[model samples]
Target: MAEQEHVEESRKDVLIVACGGSGRRVFAESEDILEAPVVFINSNDSSTIPLVPSGMEGCHGDPELASAIAFENVGAIREAFQGYKAVVVFSIFGGGTGTGMVPVILRCARDCGCKTISVIGIPLSFESARRKLAQGALGKVSEASDRMYVLDEDSVVRMCPDARVNSTFRMISHSIIFTVKCIADLLSGPFFSTFFDKVYTFAYVSEMNPVKAVEKAITASGDDPAGGIVVAVSSDLGEAESGAIYDKVAEMTGMVPDIVRRNDREDTKMVVFFSVWGA
Candidate 1:
């Protein structure tokens, strides 16, 4: 079991891929955002994989998934991740860094003989010109990562009662934080009971008028809800108006999400991940 201290770069190796952090407009004499250290907290001292926030190069505004770090950091990541059995990547959707960086990190992990799974949040709402950007990047991401699990907010909102947009965003954030924290807590606790074999996820899509299709599918399967993170991935969207769909989601779920959009070919898909915790 690894100690919880910040070890030197000379120890084990686990790579963290931070995509294009070049978004920040650097002043001539400004300090660099890429220079920020990546932070990691393991679920337990025994579990091999260490969870860390992505380090980007040009980071600013919404540090959740902005900026770009270095592929050079991969060496450090590998060293840190060494001795761990697996890799857990928490990332955002179809942006310069998260999408771009995750693939690179996964490749490095694969080369290093580590099993990699990218846990991403795909866009489930109409916030911007999502069609143009997110799809292309996701194509690259899915091609690289093994077992890509996505959570979409678009379909998740309908699961909730009526709620406002702001409230919905908060709700979404709450779930994301909840799921991550829950896993962390379990790992940290004095038990190896339920995990190392738990895989539960929800998918949300907002293309081809799939809402009715969704209703029918859920009705058929009798899927119930226990709120958590919704990873939404989509590439099959037509011309979408800004924030219209997401706003509707806000009204329906009483919780909104921080949307991460991915366009993977013609398949515009969304996945919502939630949890029903044990007492």
Candidate 2:
């Protein structure tokens, strides 16, 4: 593999690793996966997001296609990252197919010499027996990931004080998708694939941090609150969104972090931006 001599722009070469929420198995086996050009994995219809083409059984396109998607299968994640400028992982909660896939995908990115980060959405403990498998999923990435952003649905909703489970999911999912949309928007920009996007960075909340914000958010939610705007601003955050950003981060952590400033020295950006929900 050819090695990069230096770091360049912000949103250029890219690798996106997305896991299927519920219908992964279905899409995995559905001929649509092989048939469609690309399919965004999901358990259900997510309002009005752009369609990534459903992978069917007999669909045929370019044999040498630039992109390849495998629903939630980890075995093929590395393949998808091949030649990618940067890798962004988006998975709904942990466990099952996605759980096993996170580590392998992270390892693959590093092995391939590409900048990588894992963006994971952890489900609430009270969600259901199947929904709360984040422990295992988060454990692996937390150790190996350069950047890990964890969003706790249970903690985020409690901030409102009146949001229910359904409402919480909607709000959380929307926020997640919204953040993702920002990324996708970056990808859509002309300067993205050209001037920038080769480097990698991460941002997310951590297991050990301030206890105030997490406590307040959780107490209000009536459940365990350990969530906040967990993020690791990869590129230069203009130097303006610093203090206020930290203040908001303090709101989530309940206390200020020891280190939350800009560091753009490394060509390979690796940050773990987290959002704590409970104290």
Candidate 3:
């Protein structure tokens, strides 16, 4: 195994880790949109991201072998996660490295006393064997991380049937990035600390009326908010639009919503976040 000369410590409050082939590709494609530091781990020696210093070669889609390799590098992995307030793991869970490494990586983050979130993508239904493998891995990954967001590849493709294959995956990557950004913003606020264990969900709406955006976001979340809600609107949104959105959410959920105004955005995009009791 080849080793990196030194592991540079992360300076950001939040750290993002991309695991496996799909994970690495997503990060490479969307890194420009992300503000936090990102680390990559994979079995491929040719990968641009530094490989873990274990002698083992690629897992060849065997999750057990991937798990063993990750366990071997626990000390190094833990070191990477240290000093960050939160760690977000990104992976596509059908293959070997992601299915195996993600759970271990999340555990390392938790051990380092960092809040853990995982954004995982499952394979399409036609890939029956890979889908089965992903399903098996989900339980372990969910238990290991504090917050889990699952993206169904089949559903995503179905939603945009006309999109080219690569474009569809790019859309999925954007969704993951959006989730990460929203979580990072929410984590900085006082509200997140109060509901750390709640079932948090998110939705983003662009090119829609502010009030309608809120409605669509809530409806898309598929979870009824029993507690707090956070609505983040683009900078260009008017005070009137913001106020109307707030009233709409409050009327719908009977909970006063927290509004976060973004100064960086020029377009009329809104991201809605809320928490509910976990089942």
Candidate 4:
């Protein structure tokens, strides 16, 4: 781990991986914003997009089956993830495939010397059975990950109050894509080693003004950024705009922010990543 941290330019690429049906659905819609090579691993060979090995089977919502399938195909997982400096696993936890296979995948990525990060969504409060399963599976997932960013499914409703359920889920998936882009850009830079092992919560804001976007995300997360914070913005911003973002973040967190630049197209999108204690 120590040797992997200090290298300057070698570990630059990030592989964006989507696990299971829910994750693949989101990935299919948000490909344009992903900004990296994207792939999937599923229990069943059902997706239109080619699976990593073409013959991997589904787990039928059984976590034990999922884990066994992942273990049996460890070679394929390692081969698919090889040569990337970092691997970002995307899944909606609580389902059989996600809860069962994600930790195993993370461990494979780490074993192959890639920094492992999981961007996962938890079930809504009303999903009592799934929620309980998600909580139980979280510990294994957390242990295998270098950094994990959580998205609460309930927050999707609050984020888009009146939209139809499908539209709201699409919006939330876009937000998740934006966050993935931000983290991928950050890993390409020199600051990744600073926060290697911790839990974080993320938010996406697409306001034209950088300050307002950052402020809104901070307020929404309700997490103190003092421990550490990353504010990622579009690479197209002007010097003044970038400076204003830096100033706003420093004012809020009382610490210099790790700013990452990306090609966020027309909208000035900002994704804020902040650490959470004991989560």
Which candidate number has the best TM-score? 4
Q: Give the alpha carbon lDDT tens digit for every residue of 174-256 in model 2.
A: 54543443343233333232212222222212222323333343344342223323233334444544454457546644655
TM for candidate 3 is 0.76
Better of 1 and 4 by TM-score: 4
Question: Which segments of candidate 4 are over 4 A away from where they belong?
Answer: 1-12, 29-32, 47-57, 194-197, 222-226, 242-256, 263-267
lDDT of each: 0.40, 0.43, 0.72, 0.76
Q: Estimate, for each residue in 1-279, the C-alpha lDDT of model 3 and write its tens digit.
A: 111111122226788898998877778766556666788888766333445554546789988888887888788888887789889888888889999988988998999999888877877788899998897888788788777766656655644568897887777777667766655555554535544543554555564678877886776555577557777766567788878987898788888887876434645567666664552
The residue pairs found clashing in candidate 3 are: none
Error of 1 at 237 (Å): 38
User: In candidate 4, what are the lDDT values of residues 94-175, reduced to their tens digit?
Assistant: 8898889899999999999998999988877788888888878888888998889887766556554688977877768878
lDDT of 3 at 262: 49
Task: List the candidate 3 regions with Cα displacement exceeding 4 Å.
Answer: 1-11, 46-57, 124-129, 153-164, 194-196, 218-230, 247-263, 274-279
- lDDT tens digits, residues 6-72, model 1? 2222112322222222111111112121111223322112112233343422333222332234353
Worst 10 residues of 4 by lDDT: 3-12
Task: Give the root-mean-square deviation of each candidate in angstroms.
Answer: 15.8, 11.9, 6.6, 5.0
lDDT for model 2, on a 0 to 1 scale?
A: 0.43
Task: Show model 2 residue runs off by greater than 4 Å.
Answer: 1-9, 22-76, 181-279
Model 1: runs farther than 4 Å from truth?
A: 1-69, 178-279
lDDT of prediction 4: 0.76
Best of the two (2, 3) by TM-score: 3
